[model samples]
Target: MTPSNILSVEAYFDLICPWCLIGKRHLETAIDLLARERPDVTVQLEWRSYPLIPATPPDGIPYRDFYVARLGSPQAVAVRQAQVIAAAREAGLTLALDRIETFPNTMLAHRLVRFVRTQDGAAAAATLVDNLFTRYFMRGANIGDGHVLREALAECGIQSPLEQGASVQHDMDWLPPLNGPDDPPPRAGLGVPHFIFNGTHSVSGSRPPEALLEAMLRALARAKQIATRAVA
Candidate 1:
């Protein structure tokens, strides 16, 4: 398939996951590199919903407890988090892991993303997700808080209360469930930052830039083929 015939790529992710932010940066860098190599290929990016730790309480869990419970020991958790931070840096993302105070439920954030999609489609959603990640992971802001989430949406040019209202109304229908009878079971119950490319290719975790670049290129090719067949 030719570059010109390639359609957009949809990325499913959540803001709270550190790996998701790293993966996002890698994908963006890959897209930039691809653009330089193949100037004619226009890849529109679409951000979809995939919440991590969806059943988290609204008030948020203590970061230390959460990490220790997941990683066994406080020291081990710190080491693991440090590894993620180093990886994020290598991916050109500055993550201030020390500043994160709370691990709030991301349901509201996901809902807000759905709301943005209605107004500006996927582009706005992408912007919002990027901002939220930067704010939460890099700057160590409380993304679980309604005020912070609202402000982040506003930064992306969305009206706060109105958008929130719309999101609340359509949250169940628009946003994908984390886990329930209605939710589609993830591929092997994958974690956050899981990416399904063109509904065929699956990539999980914070992959390197080169790997994501290859995935995107492959997804683009598959998309082009499907589009051409449809037209034919």
Candidate 2:
């Protein structure tokens, strides 16, 4: 397989978002399908940090109350959660939304991902990402807490002390600053759980595995075309 056969999938997500977890599941399934169908193609998955609710306090706030306030009422929150739950269920994942207490400030969590990626490698960082998501969404753990983050890091076989302070912020230097209230929205203005294929095709939101798979295939084709053009 040539370099052109490698498909890069960049996923922008926030750990606190249930949809990001569901999106991760879909992306995984899509990769599996691509592997089965295109044995010669290699998919490189990169997870980017996109904090959906950056304004949340460093210590975080009550999860239920946060949603209730944002969505207007308890009934509205329930309806929205139910919709997300149904989507997650379809993806073969379960989200314990009701059990979550803190909405959490995900800066530390995202920085931890970058730290693990730098020290251990992308694969280790991916494992840590999965662990963090599970801890928060499934186990209702507060990922914002340094203690919880350290535990999650240890679970991923990372024994080094958790990086903190100004250094943690520097870990995110590779990407642009998080969107501010006044800044124009991100690509497509679709927010977290956004997927970019080979930096060419982008799909926003938690789309189905099939749709993601299609995007991967299209990206691979475009890569091949570009490679051919270069040779010509």
Candidate 3:
């Protein structure tokens, strides 16, 4: 319940996760729909960082091997890869899994996002985020690499030095929704594409844009009810 009836939508995710990228697209589409359908509703979007693998070195680990260990076998990895590729296509995203040879730590990437979001604005942060996803997932660039991040920042019109943002900490403690109750219940996990709408509604994983739009509507309705109660 913001002063100006601003609706808050937070996407909790890690950059290295492919599913998160798909989820991001769905959220973005939902944002567009919300803007067109309900122009009266003001929304605030935040991209919160949640590193999936904190143990991986900044240099990154072998891409194939990392999944092979996590998923159990090469065949399993192939199956998952195919599944992700299919899902990505449906979302209008082309993922070059073959180009991704290494899985680098995304701590610094998260830090950069934090800096850009706080210093610049949500739109600027989103452009940088989208650029990073395109570079790493589409072109197979190493997002964990400092040079790669610098290039991404430059492409997104961020002239800040990469050296200024170098924190790689992983903090995944659960807290209430972004715009929900006065006291939010704690929740924790490593799920990407997790969306919390107005702290009143939350949907996890890479769902369809329609589903996200429904959640947004529910959140807005809830906000209206809350505001009504506040005035009464």
Candidate 4:
């Protein structure tokens, strides 16, 4: 058995992305598997905000129409959504895309998550994340609505004073623009459901649980090597 070590993981996601929810499920499974295989290793996970389309209006646009236009036609949209549904099913998720009516601007939602993390904790924020995804995809709630967000926050037991606003206004202070020229390739054009292990190894897209577990092992091994070299 290896000596104890802590593995840090950062997950960048957008609330509106179905794959983000699916990827989150896989990551949880991977974490559980890692705990069984390497009891000596502890995982520290943090969720980061990455809005796919920041330009989306606060009120949002018609969800089905948005996809139809983006994917060229309703048939193409159907095909793409079908693929998403199949992938989600594999992760034990059932996404009701038909229930969704509006494609919301996720900026407010992400800001609220940060706020919750600050006021409560990571676990509380995580619960809010799950609630937000479920509300939008499963119940077809327009998450961009302040009322909707407040309802989710209440469900998470977050009693922050910001509850009245339903939106947190940190002004994107923590994160830099995704398209910054200084960023590297994948970082610049990174897709949602991206994960970084130990701040070095990265896995993009909604990969399988096995793949995530392998990445965690690799990150742990690298951390061990660095510690060994430091002692030497």
Candidate 5:
């Protein structure tokens, strides 16, 4: 089997999830590694929306208590926060948990992402996704609000209405074919930081860049084998 160009990676994530942002950073690093190691392979990164707190209001829920309740106790949440901070540090990112006040419904943001992708392309969508995460996690902006979504898009050079025509409803009506019927379920259930490589292999969670890089290479090899078989 001979490896070729055009390796596609699709990521399912939520802007509100700190771990998801960490995953983004890790994936970015892995892509850089891919570029250096396999110059012939073109890595196509596609972002998919997977809202974590979809039912929260546009304004949002209180940040601290939301985690306290979700993780069982203040101590548990503190531990989680500490863990996130440590992981974020490795990826050269900060969670800024203290400044954040909202646990927002991210449907509007997803709509904006789709609109940007429709108008511009995958690169634009990736930029918007990064902005959404930065606005939510670093600067503590409420991404659920239409205004904030618009601001993020503006930062990304994508001009679009955040709310006027966009539905606040669930945006994932048509899912990407990252997984197929013949293959085993890649996950136990839906989880953010789900990464599928070349539409043939996948790995979930905010794994380190090394693991992701390995997965990407493996997917490429599998793709090459399949391509060779087809030709033969």
Candidate 6:
């Protein structure tokens, strides 16, 4: 397919969400599978912003309390968390549930991702996601902390823009315009980890690699049909 007819997917998510991380891993597997199946198909990925706890303080809150509050019943919450841990392990990811001390604001991390998107593209954003997940879920680091963020970014080969804030902004346009109360959310009527395929269809949550590949193929077909109709 031509570059114009290629499929594009924009994934909206936050680093704090375990399901989001699982979804990302599945998506990566799907991409690899698709590349092998259809060498002609080109997929463009864009990572968009979705903060799970926008109101979360910079210092963060204890994970146990957070889950108990959100899930209501302590027993049910434990069961659900166990499932998440197992799922993460199955996906070749280590999730240390007990070690997580706090859940912090992901706004700045999202901003950092947006910045990385401008400078190094989607791959960089993916790396940031992976790093943040590992840090928070496995290493039990406070992601909302600037020091931790800087360290993670450096590990991912992304220079800390905050250190040299002014120069970095000029070079990468890292500063995003503030969204007012009236401003709409990133994607219209879409939830966390929502994947918009080639501006045609939307897929939400963590889906199997087979499902993702099917959606990608459908998106590619849709693009071709649109191109043909335009010519006619």
Instruction: Point to the candidate with the largest TM-score.
Output: 4
Q: Which has the greatest lDDT?
A: 4
**Residue 18, model 2: Cα distance from true site in angstroms:** 0.8
* Deviating ranges (above 4 Å) for candidate 2: 163-190
Residue pairs with colliding backbones in model 2 are: none
lDDT of 1: 0.74
Native-vs-model 2 lDDT? 0.82
Candidates, ranked, lDDT: 4, 2, 3, 5, 6, 1
* Residue pairs that clash (backbone atoms under 3 angstroms), model 1: none
Better of 1 and 5 by TM-score: 5
How far residue 192's Cα lies from its native spot in candidate 4, in Å, is 1.5
Candidate 4, residues 1-232, lDDT tens digits: the string is 3332888888899998999999999999999999999887878787887888989987899999899889999899999999999998999988899989999998888877876666677788788999999999889999988778778878878886554442433434442344245323345567879999997788988999999999999988888888788879
Cα TM-score per model: 0.82, 0.88, 0.86, 0.89, 0.86, 0.87
List pairs with backbone clashes in candidate 3: 180-199
Model 1 reaches what TM-score against the true structure?
A: 0.82
- The true-versus-predicted C-alpha distance at residue 90 of model 6, in Å, is 3.0
- Least accurate 10 contiguous residues by lDDT in model 5: 175-184
Model 6, 152-176: lDDT tens digits are 8779888655666444223435555
| Per-residue lDDT of 26 in model 3 | 88
Residue 151, candidate 6: alpha-carbon lDDT: 82
Q: Which digits, one per residue and each the tens of the lDDT, describe model 5 over residues 1-232?
A: 1445778888988788888999999999999998999888888887877666667876678888788889999999989889999989988997788888888877767766766776789999999888888888889888877667656766787765433454333343442222234223334467888999988888889999999999999998888888889989
Name the runs in model 5 displaced over 4 angstroms. 1-3, 162-188
For model 3, residues 128-214, the per-residue Cα lDDT tens digits are 989988988989998888678778877888756444553323332221123234323236664777899988799989999999999
